[model samples]
Target: MKLLLITAIEEFEKDVINILKNSRLKAFSYQSVKGFKNDKNEMKNWFGKDDIAVDSLLFTVFSEYNCVDSIYKNINEFNSMQQTVPHIHIVTINLEDENFR
Candidate 1:
């Protein structure tokens, strides 16, 4: 079992979801977040009144390590095909076990 965390820009939220869907990922979670990066990492045009920067975060877990490969491939493909700064960040955590009631 494994856990996949995807933190991406708001604009790519839909793309991420679509990619997950295409990969047959059925269970996942998401939320809208408001935060700011460092001065150098800050967005060039993310200011919206008072210069606040916000973004969306998506998280999902897979029962198999192999299942994650497809999503990673899709994300890589998207990243390679697009010309954008601040690419999405993906974190993978290996789970020892999971209990579901």
Candidate 2:
């Protein structure tokens, strides 16, 4: 088994969920999170800030390797058709031991 972590801005929550469902992901968990970026140039706004915070979501999925691969493919297709900067990010970690009860 592997641990898949997917993160995206809240605005794309529905789309992300759809991707997971289409991938046949049986179970998963997600939570609201604050995403931060430290880009001085992009921070030059009316408030004159050095950083910015974005409302985001983090999804955790534990599944087999094939399932994880399917999710990655789906997310890549979704991101390619986007015309914005924020896109879904996915990472997978190898689980040394899969015993979880």
Candidate 3:
């Protein structure tokens, strides 16, 4: 089992969720997170619109490694669909228990 952690703009949450669902991966956790970009003193837009700001954190678990690439690809496609560049972070980890909350 592995955990795929991603931090993205709040507006992209739904798109990410949909991609996960379509990828057939289940069970995840998320929270509203406030964070800034790597570049400070500069504001950027996702699709050249609203100013950059803190968004959401997306955490999901996958039981298989095979699904990783597909999940990422779908997310990239979704971001492109919205005419926005993908600004996501990915983390893979092994889990000791399924009951973790």
Candidate with the greatest lDDT versus the true structure: 2
lDDT-wise, the better of 1 and 3 is 1
lDDT of 2: 0.81
Model 1 pairs in collision: none
Question: Worst 10-residue stretch by lDDT in candidate 3?
Answer: 40-49
Badly placed stretches (over 4 Å) of model 1 are 39-52
Cα lDDT for residue 57, model 3? 64
lDDT tens readout by residue for model 3, 10-98: 77677667777787875666777865555534444322233455656665555477778888887666655665553555567777677
Tens-place lDDT digits, model 2, residues 1-101: 88999888898899989988888878999999987767766623212234667788999999877788789988999889887777888889999997776
Write down the lDDT of every candidate, Cα atoms only. Answer: 0.70, 0.81, 0.64
RMSD of 2: 4.6
State in Å the error of residue 58, model 3.
3.0
Q: Estimate each model's TM-score.
A: 0.76, 0.85, 0.65
Give per-residue CA lDDT, model 1, range 1-101, as digits (tens). 77898877788888888887887765778787764655644554232223447665655656466668988888888878777664666778988878843
Model 3 bad stretches (over 4 Å): 38-53, 94-101
In candidate 3, the residue pairs with backbone N, CA or C atoms under 3 Å apart (3 or more residues apart, or in different chains) clash, namely: none
Better of 1 and 2 by TM-score: 2
